[model samples]
Target: MAGEIPRAQPPPAEPDPVRDAHPYVLLWQWRRNPLRRRTDRLRAWIALGLALFVLLAAPAAMYAVGDTVHRHYRSTAEHEARTRDQRPAVLVHDAPRHPEPGSDEARETRYPVEVRFTGPDGAVRTGTTDVEPGLPADSTVLVWVDAAGEITGPPLTADEIRSRTMGWALLAFLGVVLAGLAAHGVAGLVLHRRNLAGWDAAWADTARRWTRAP
Candidate 1:
């Protein structure tokens, strides 16, 4: 065994979160090493901050945004349901039964038409509303009317509110993550340049000392 040449050890494998919390993986640069620069430690701190932000602040922000969106949508739905009323309307004219020629619209696209309805106050209201295609004039239809008897769109459904809240909440979470990454990247770049500048200064000082004029 003494005469056999020693084999080189294999390089360390990449970090595995499943294997461990990988705390050392994140703080590797923070360790005391002769080759490590001040900027390297700063970069490690920045990485740790970014990780914490993603784990903590990002979720908090997402919850806050989702809650706000849900509350807003729910409030609007309640308000509309309370202030608005559905009424039977009579079509003043025929509804468009067919899509326009050379158009991408479906044959059953609902088209706006003039209609007459009684409002919550029972006063007659005339407004334009979308109706199924091909309804002849003087057809009975149901429409939504505001407190002032103005025609309005239907309120949001439960599913729609949840879906929209989730969509915006996801976007908010991603936005926060991207913002943190961008900030960290910028900080790293600045620190890297500073580190290079420090090295350049050290080399220049060394050159001046070694080549001093006789």
Candidate 2:
């Protein structure tokens, strides 16, 4: 081994104790790094935009649905009432049928009978009238019929139905909006955590490569 050409033994393999430790070190390093700080700020902006979008869109969507429902109910109630008022009264010869198995055969004539009317648009409507039921047939009374020979019931007000429907729609919309917001917030948090983890791993890889060179 003196000058004859000393046999070179390979350098002992160094155990990479820092390999596993590097990830934690890089995570800490990234927390203090300016570039990562900028990314955090950007994420904050994205979250803010998402919140603003929900706030702005929810009310508008709710308004549109409410408006449509209100219009439908209003038109339906008004058309029903108008049709009922125009229906011609007819006379019937029958006895009133009481719920009781056997009741008195009362032949009382009265004005205004409730009748159901079908509009030209095929919408079924109900309205009450002061038409009288005439005659008696087997203890069953015949009430006045409309021009179309349909029974009419109590009329509903357009405004009342629209108001009630609108209120319920608003409540449902609010519930959906709240649920969406909660989901969005959770998603944002999960994204932020994943991004942070990725950044840490990348930093550790770069540091390890640089240290091993030369």
Candidate 3:
């Protein structure tokens, strides 16, 4: 009995849930854990960079678009104001209720109507211009006129410019954010595939060693 060898104890069984119940880490790949691989760290850094890029680049794009749109619309308004002016005009005929064929009702809400307006030279003039439907004959309406006394559209209002700038800026911001997210997703997919391949190779190596075991 004193010379007998002791029996080898079996390893304890590990449940999947228990093995995977590790606490969440904010940036586990950035840690110096022995299980962390070079690809893992690279993927973590890439994710961080993309997140920063989205935050920084989105606002930058928004501001650039807003400034550019504001300047262009402001200049356009100034030019139109200089070249155009409003004139008192009387409708000579009823405004057409029906929109022209192949026209969008949303945009072509107003129909063209004949109007009598005073010219730049003080002579009475007749012109066809846009007006709301159902306007009766002899109804007064303010019409825009160009330098040559021709009927024209009104200049861009402040409200219109501000709205357009805000819309474009918002679109630019969304575009930047979406682009950054897409890039990050693509990079993550690539890293995930690489990690899977490495894991497969390591498992294969382990299996081969197990087959040769006594």
Best by TM-score: 1
lDDT of 2 by residue, 1-214 (tens): 2224232333333223257567654344235554445545555566567667778777877877787777777777777666654433222324234344333433334444444444444566554444324424222222333335455563567668867777867875786688667866677677667666766676666556555635
Q: Rate the local accuracy (lDDT) of all candidates.
A: 0.80, 0.55, 0.81
- Model 2 TM-score? 0.43
In order of appearance, the predictions have TM-scores of: 0.77, 0.43, 0.69
- As a whole number from 0 to 100, the lDDT of residue 100 in candidate 3 is 51
For lDDT, candidate 2 versus 3, the one ahead is: 3
User: Per-residue lDDT tens digits of candidate 1, residues 1-214?
Assistant: 3334333333334334446667775566767878767777888788888988888888888899999999999999999889887789999999876756335574447889999988877788799998877789999999988888899978888998999999989998998999899988899789877876776677666656556655
Please, what are the lDDT tens digits per residue for candidate 3 over residues 15-74?
233356655455566769787778778877888898899999999999999999999999
Q: What TM-score does candidate 3 reach?
A: 0.69
Off by over 4 Å in 3: 1-24, 96-112, 116-133, 147-150, 212-214
Error of 3 at 28 (Å): 2.1
Clash tally, candidates in order? 0, 23, 0
Where does model 2 exceed 4 Å of error?
1-39, 85-153, 168-176, 179-183, 186-190, 196-200, 203-214
